[model samples]
Target chain A: MTQPQSRIRRSFGDLSERALAFWLLVPAALLLGLVALYPVGRLLYTSLFRRRLTDETGNSPVFVGFQNFVQAFSDERFWTALWNTLLIVLVTVPGALVVGLLLALLANLPFRVKWPIRLGLLLPWALPLVFAGLIFRWFFDSQYGVINDVIVRLGGERLLWVTTPELLFWAICLSIIWKSSSFVALILLAGLQVIPKELYESAAVDGANRWQSFWRITLPLLIPAILVAAIFRTITAFQTFDIPFAMQNGGSSFETLAMYVRTMSIENLNFGYGSALAVLMFLISFVVTLVYLRYVRGADD
Target chain B: MKKLFWLLVAVLLASTALAQQTRLRVFVGGQQRPDVMRKIFDLYQSRNPGVRVDVEVGGATSDQQQQYLTTVLASRDPSIDVILIDVIRPAQYLASRWADTIDKYLPAASRQELLRRYLPAYSQANVINGQLVALPAFADAMFLYYRADLLEKYGFKPPTTWDEAIQQAQTILQREGNPNLNGIGFIGAPAEGTVCTFLLPIWAAGGDVTNAQGQFSLTVEQAQRALQFWVGLMDQKVSPPNMAEKPQDTIRSEMQAGRWVFGTLFAYAWNRFQNDADSQVKGKIGVVPLPAFAGGRQASCLGGWQWTVSDFSRNKAQAHRLVRFLSSPEVSKILAIEASNLPVFPALYRDADILKVNPWFGQALPVVQAARARPQHPRYAEISEAIRVTTNQVLARQKTPEQGAREIVTRLQAIYGGR
Candidate 1:
């Protein structure tokens, strides 16, 4: 008994700070494993099996390894969804960033209506996705839509903003920009507020123009904020679902990767294929984010 | 005074806990006739004070509600005592054997009454493999709402075939001479509405997604023909170009805006088409059965909701009672009139009160009698997506009729293994 007690005391004495931290973090780590790691592991494992929600053969999964991936690769919908997702990311990220930067710059200025403008900026992000989608849908309505009415009043043709696939794609982009740019603007504005006024005063003392100062001082200092905003916007645009889903109702041409996962899983009830698609989506986003971070790190160096 | 207040609070909390034990949770779509549902639930509560029903209204759309129900049933969850099932959901439920059978839980008298009074299609459709999986709750069928004044002005009878429909539409478009006015409108948006509208003529032509012979009888060719015929309306400029992406509501609004000579809509549209204050065609509209392909049988796609007790439910008895109460003749009549539901009970068709409220249902009878239910496959959702995609493709002019039909065949075969 004395030997065991002495061993316990030695073990306690052997606890390094890092070891103590590791022991203390064990619960949280296990919790993360249970919540995040488990679902991901299960999703990966489930993807290897033929598991139908309404599997008449009892809920036992029949293993069909890699067939789901093969099926997905062969499927036309998969390709369409991938391309659409890429298109949305490519288009919306830049569109939102530019607009957000402009808005942030305007918001940084000493305008009398700054508060009202800020409130208006916050409104899109504050409104729920469905409500914002509905508003945009109405505004772009082919008949009696405010936008259409404006166009018609200007003696232009009343376009099928929500009907035609091409137009619907643009409309979805418009709504996404409408909803997300506000968030980006808010982020950039915080970054803009932190920039020292003395740098701008010094630049002014040195006879640098406003545009030159903005390009030379504001943008360089704002790079970290821009990266953060871009990364956030990029991830969101990659997983484009609600706006397109609400605005265009998943038009055949505009099925995003997220929508494809949903169509396969929820709508088709083919959980195995859906899981494979979801895993693939996660992988794509992971790789893109890694590449992005590498590029950012390289640029920094 | 503080001690007395605490004692009163304790009593209230104790009673509330007891009340919670007996509460039955129900899954109801909030979007569908909620006021009428509330009224009926209120009536039930007033009658049965001991039991409490907690209606969890959810999902803006029936599809979303179906998804919620699917998730609940996937885990064999017992929390939802009674679920309001879309007409197509029973097959999925029955495949999993998740929902309790009404025949087992319902009282003998109420079960017998339901059997005797329920409409044949509904009664038959609610059963799976000879087991009564659910009870008929309400009825819905597609109705063709036509401009009576325009048809009369154009000296045409309501077109009884797709061929005739196109011709009539073109003539009306030319004669109406209003650029804004189109020949026809339909819920052609690639949704469940599109699936229902697109299938109406094909079904009337004795075509189906699958036939009674346990074979994939619906050829891509037939589906293609249906698609071609639908697309012909757009091609001929008879139906407005905008109609291709319009939902039933948009179609109805367009009709009310007096821009169409004919429109296809649900049973709920009858009242609004005839009576709504904003309606442009009120009192000037006539109803007809959806015209078939030439020399084919008449058809209207069966659409409605069903009520089933969840198998895992702890309060199955209360759920049965609620189902029985909802299906009773009096409540059903109220449902039919106030909610504008097409009653699934055969006896209520001739009810004076129902007729007084829905005069157009007189025309709705023959159509209801001939309604065609979508194939009740366990994989019905997949079958429906296939239909929606194929129809949308054809309507959008992305594929030829033959191509769309072939695509449908390919899609179905991919899912069902083409036995």
Candidate 2:
């Protein structure tokens, strides 16, 4: 045992820096595998069968290779949830990005009482998702909600915000943007700090107006930050669950992919189909994230 | 030597007795719920000194509790020995093997006597595969609550049929235009309420969602006919157009706010209607059976909880002992008085205290007796979802009754046997 232990120590001492770096990373690499690969593996395994939790005759667990996936292709709810996810990401990403950039620019200005403005901009991001959902839910409630009260006071009809299909989806998008825009703003603010004051001065000396400098100088340099923020915000938006769940109970109007997975796995107890859906969700998120990463890398190159 | 041997034997026996004493964790919904159930569990503990029973009040509502239970049971964790069972959950729990049949723990002769003594609807809800998986903890069923003042002023007696209710509602809506009031309040939200509301008419019409053969016994016509009647209420302006989205709680709040001329709500809301400080319709309401189709039976969907032993429990004996004690007639009476719950035992209705608390119980007894249960399929959650989806569609005018029926049938078929 001593001989083997000494040999192990010698091998570690002999390891090259690159190999040693990898060797040192083994524990973290294992942790990453556990955190990421285990659930995906379990999901993949469950997806390979009809693993309904209920032992009722028709619902009995049985091997049904790729059948759940095949069924998903034709499921209207699955398609609806998928469409809603894409629509929400489409709405929220740009919404947050534009708002984030504006806030960042405002914050970067030579201004008075800067910390309060920065804190106010960052406050929504600091709130938990559930709390944000509750606040926004109250904001849009058709009855006694603040938004409806203002509308009614202004001689406008109270919209059925959480009930109407299009209105509810937009409400979800609005909630997502409200909750995450600050996070993006913070990222852009950090990016803004790195830009030298001389670039703007040089642009000004070249007869460039503020708008022209903003467009030509700040815009190009800030693209990297915007891209980074957009990639992360897009990924987060893909897994939107808590806000919509809090807004309404079980209407399929605003069901996202994560919502569908939860409804199937948790509510319906159809773990097999739920797992298949989850695997599909993981794949989609992975692919989207990779695509965004590749685009960012390409831009850098 | 003999005295020493006897002392050793006695000591060993004492230690064995101590080791055999079992402690159990019983999970229930809401903090108030455990307080109500504590008397029974306390009684259980007193009788069995060897057992210690701890009541855990978990989720705020039955829905939340069910979700927690589902997660825990899905892992087959033994943390919960005795669990609260929603009326609609026995089939699901039994099918999943999350629950164990408690028949073995019950005395055969006493079990038969108890079964015969309880209300058939209440007892039957706990039976799956002819095995006693659970026992009803209380009695509850849905009811049609109306604004007495509005109905009297409008010169309408309580509607005995769905058609009459709608006609009366339409007249009320057209004439009143009170802006503070609608014709009717309904539970049309896509949660369990919608399914329960839809089940009322379906069961009244002598239809069921599925049969015991694991078959889709619900015909297309049964669903379409029910949906046509229900959706007509919405289309004719007798029911709120937003009924498809308002949950039962919303409708209840509306009812208590004096916002609806007629409302359908759960029986538990009877107390709140009369006594809640927020109630705007206090002393202005009357309870009645759910209106059915003309020439059809009046029906309400049964709603109650059961006490189920977890399959993973090592202390099932202690759990069942507690269940047996809590559901006993005397204890059930105490439960009714303590918790303001309707009793599962038929005899408890005759109790003066119970009748006093819920004065509407006398008028609603027939409805309770006739209350219909949902399908006992193992995929009940999915089946219930189908009901909610289809009914919401019909109410929303997104699908015609016929199309809604077709969609529901198709979805259910896919659930049971699909590609």
Give the best candidate by lDDT: 2
Q: What TM-score would you give candidate 1 relative to the actual structure?
A: 0.88
Worst 10 residues of 1 chain B by lDDT: B105-114
Off by over 4 Å in 2: A1-26, A56-61, A292-301, B1-21, B107-109, B152-156, B167-177, B211-215, B416-419
Instruction: Give the worst 10-residue stretch by lDDT in candidate 2 chain A.
Output: A52-61
Interface RMSD of candidate 1, in Å, is: 2.5
Q: In candidate 1 chain A, where is summed lDDT lowest over 10 consecutive residues?
A: A245-254
Candidate 1, B1-419: lDDT as tens digits: 99999999999998887776567887888756777887888888888876777788887666778777777777788889988888887877887777888877656776666687788888878887777888877888987788889889979999888778889888878776888787778877767778887677688777887768667677766777778777778888887666656777777877887877888888877777766898878788888888877788778888888888898999888888898787677777888888778888776788888989887767777788789888787888788887786677667665677887888888888767722
Can you give the DockQ of every candidate in the order shown?
Answer: 0.40, 0.47
For every candidate, give the share of true A-B contacts it also has. Answer: 0.45, 0.63
Estimate, for each residue in A189-265, the C-alpha lDDT of model 2 and write its tens digit.
99999989999899888999999999998989988889899999989889988889877764665688999999898
What is candidate 1's lDDT per residue for A1-301, written digit by digit as tens? 6999898678877899898788879999999999989999999998998887766533778899999999989988899999999999998999999999998988889987678989988988898887777888889887768999999999999898876678888888888888999999999999999999999999999999999999999999998899889998998788888888777654454689998898878877788889999999989888878978887898789
Give the RMSD in angstroms, all C-alphas superposed, for model 1: 5.2
